[model samples]
Target: MKFYFFNAPAPASLEVFRQEYVSQNLKKLRLAAYLAMSVSCGIIMLPLVFPVLNQTRHATFYRGLNISLIFSSALALGFEHVLTKGTRKQPPYWVGQLLCLGFAFAFICSCLGITFIAQSNPKNTLTMYLLGLGTVAFLWDFDYLETLVLVALTSLAFTLVVQLSFLSPEQALLNHCMSFVILVCFYFLSRIMYSYRANHFLQLKEIEEKNLEIQKMSQAKSEILGVVAHDLRSPFNNIEMITSLLQKKNLTPEQEQQYLGLILTSCQTSRNTINELLYLAREEQLEAIPLERLDICELLQQVQQEWQSQLQGSKDLKLLHPPAPLYAQLNKDRFHRIMDNLLSNAVKFTPANGKILIRVREEKKKLQLEVTDEGIGIPERIRPLLFERFSKARRRGLQGEKSTGLGLSICRQLVEQHGGSIDVESEERKGTTFHITLPAVK
Candidate 1:
């Protein structure tokens, strides 16, 4: 199959997605509540218009009540539709609050007007008005103690109006008590639901803010690493070249050998440090390079040739590969770095006469590579964090080799960049195997 770079758009930021979800949910909930209120009110007030429930009623009062409720319900539906559009510019919070309050007040007024027009027994009329007002107030701002107090006062006023105007003593007292009780229960239930929804929205908002902060910090860190690495490379390159030149100059035979060895070792150490810094810099500045199909067998052979002298000196060194050629789409430079780090690690940690094996194979559309070594395997606790940058998993090699604790991290980054994964299986004093898997090109 042919490989191509597909530049998919970056996913939406967490904050944006979260905000949209919450807005949609709240809009749905409010719309449902408004619809229920409108339908229930309309059904309950039907008797006032039909004249079956009462005959001593004013036509103007009944007409006004019905018209107000119809308009309020229509306005509520319009607001809900506007909310559902998901436009960037939302109506102001105060405007929305006013709209909700206006609808609720109109609904309450309609219930009271209908009650007064239909009933001669003031007990029932006052009960209807108090219950409507209390419900509307609680729904408008359920968590406010002041609103609950207003509901209580309205209930008490209703009781007075019933007793003074038309209710029998016993009936007025009983209806008043029941209305107040109902108001209290509705207020508490509405308050609880409101609190829960508010807290849920707050928690989601906090998480979104944290995610944004983390993304910003990651970007800043990557940029800083890139800058520092770029600045360090030039001086180190000059130093390595100067050291090489000095090593080749004429000198006393005894002194020449000692000086040459010192210069070469210094250059090597500098070169290794430079390589580590470069890897880190690149990781910060770039996403994974797009993969290109190449022969892994050829790449490994070339790497082995580069490190031939070092591998030849170790009598126990063993390199193994499948007889058939293996091909993969990978970033070549990154792949080489990963392999070199693992091989060098094995050589350093393995004792004399201890074997090291580099093995490769294909398994079910995946390419697997394993580097096994009869070396002092990593400690159990240390293994988990082995691939973390600058992790404190330091150990002296058999030959006392120095390390910067960066190789494994670089290896991990490179493997992941190719849409692959790496893992280790090790037993102390037995062996360690670094296993890597990549998607195979069809």
Candidate 2:
């Protein structure tokens, strides 16, 4: 009793979504055109079919009917050509309307053609087969109202032909029933087509979005490589220069040690840079590292002791936490690497007399860790890219220690492996605080 109509107009995003999928629609239209041509080819050769069947008596009438049907098929196929004339672009708003009308008109002629053949050969099963083919092709891309129109016009054409066809009343009744059957089959088949088009378009949209995302990531990767290449050139030059200095014929022991130390430092810096690049390049491997329950207090204690020995008690490094065994699911070695880089950065940036704070607590059923440094903090402009590879956040420590601009990025990657995230807060000349949050376990 009730029926819906043309798909409700979508949101602006879906309108844009539709624009992206013009190629798929155009391909469907081309295939439909070919299908129409196939039907027309058979109809155009109907005179030969009559002669082969030894029915030359009515071959003239069937030939004329087939000619009209062929013209209609040609016209319908011509409309489909509009989509293929040039490079694929967004289809016009009326493309669906025009295409459906074309198919509908062709279908009307096809039904009349079938009526004539069936009336001439009352027991011809070919009428049923042709009706099925024309209905499917006509309603392939039709909406509810459009489908209703197709069926009505086709039924009207079939009825008019039957009345003028001069077949017996019994034959007319049988063909009328067959018409009803074809219309019902077309109605449900068109509904299925509606679902098919929607899903097909949705898949294209997703693939397009993923391709765009991969393209953006590829561009970013290239930029990072360029920065890495530029960064590597200097330290490698330093190492080569220092290697040459070590080869002097005569040199003092202290002087020799100093040059050797410089070479070692250069090698270490280059190694760290390459390690960061490899980690970023192969992030998928990080997912395989399994996590285990880790004691937060013990880890922070180890970090403090390590830094205590490294900085030689020159700066105040404090570990702040509540007196509890705060446990969390974490990969210990990876987490240690995260803390190592953060503390190394804290020590490098904080002035000798400045303070560094490592705080851990439970917040919202998650473990929260913050590394606060009271030294040259990040500039507001650079803070956004602080964790990005080869970021503009690169800065010399208070002691003029070289920065690879890779430490925070490595820390973030390691944290993410444990199903957590890292963030930072800072103000120039005042201090910077880096926060790491992970899901806490009881």
Candidate 3:
């Protein structure tokens, strides 16, 4: 059997997919700020390590370092806002990459200059540069392998820088090793956090989709139940009426024949109504059979033949179509019910001498079948709920017959189940039209 995808859009582009990544980044912004605060605290304690804090030159050096930390923190806050805004209209990926690289370089230069002015020593510069490289690597969109490489390289670079700084190589090496261990821990912690947030967001989306599907299923079930209750009652009522009439005694041969005919017709109506209900129940229970290719034109013609006896006494019941055959991928039983419902409604509503036209045509990979009737059209107030279950509209015909009000609702459900749509247009006291559009078989 052939299958067709529903109306959902195709998979989104990478930029759109990156929007989810940005949401995860928002949570990290708070942690990043905390890290910045800790770094600022370290910068403030640097003066305690120096013996000449009372000197004007040393005091100015400490003040500059404090100012730089505050400036970096403020810039970091602005970057947090940019991430939160979540706008896709930002510059291309390459532009964002360049901008981030530029910021990293500027921050590295600032840290190096501060260190140089304070001690006039280039020995500890490599330690600061390694830390800067770690921060820069964190900001880049690096894969897992790249991140591991960056962490290892930064650790090695920091170890070398510290070893060259002091007279005692052993103490310097121990300190550098400790700092490298901390950097590695922070890197892994960030990676774990990112993974957790991504999984959580996906879980939330899946729950939402399931909830929506449940709601649709519940609604469809309710509609089917309501329609079945109403449609089933009508035939039972007719059976009661026919039995009541048959109880009369001393009837002529012609009267008996008429009563017998009425009984037969009522039984057939009852059977057809039950079949429609069964179809609706099956669909609601999620037992909808697969669709297959069927000749729609032949299907409609057969439906017309089934109702030929009823329409024979009426006037101007016409089937209009081109000679070419039209085929569609649909459930034959369900499509038959749809056509039967439409035709029955048309015949019941249209007056004697009024026209009922059935037309099937093809348009660009779709099959369009329409049934138009010159009948007492639907009222505007009732039209809104015309396809709703148990919604009885104003019924007027040549003999003023009533309706079960389930036919249109069943037709709509059947059409939708076949991956098609049905619509109605009517003008009160003028005419009514029902149009069904189905996907043409490939």
Among the numbered candidates, top lDDT falls to: 2
Ranking by lDDT: 2, 1, 3
Tens-digit lDDT track for model 3 on 1-442?
1111111112442344245544433434445545655777776766688746646455676566656756765666576557445565643444343334334445554454455445545455445655665565454443244446545655554554454445366656666656666666646654554344444555666688899989977876775676567655776787788778778887877988987887777777667666656755667677455888888888878877777767775757667766877888878777777887888788777888778888889999988888999988888888888787656663544575556556788788888888889988999889899988989885
Candidate 2 wrongly placed segments (more than 4 Å):
1-184, 191-228, 246-253
Kindly list the per-residue Cα lDDT of model 1 for residues 265-319, writing each as its tens digit: 6567667766776668778678648779988877887777766667676636556
lDDT of 2 by residue, 192-278 (tens): 665566566666777999999899789767867786788778888998998888899788899999998988887887887787777
Compared with the true structure, all predictions reach lDDT values of: 0.66, 0.73, 0.64
Estimate TM-scores for all models. 0.51, 0.59, 0.59
Q: How should the candidates be ordered by TM-score, best one leading? A: 3, 2, 1
lDDT of 1: 0.66
TM-score of 3: 0.59
Q: State, as a TM-score between 0 and 1, how close model 2 is to the true structure.
A: 0.59
Error of 1 at 396 (Å): 2.8
* Root-mean-square deviation per candidate: 16.1, 10.2, 8.3
lDDT of 3: 0.64
Off by over 4 Å in 1: 1-267
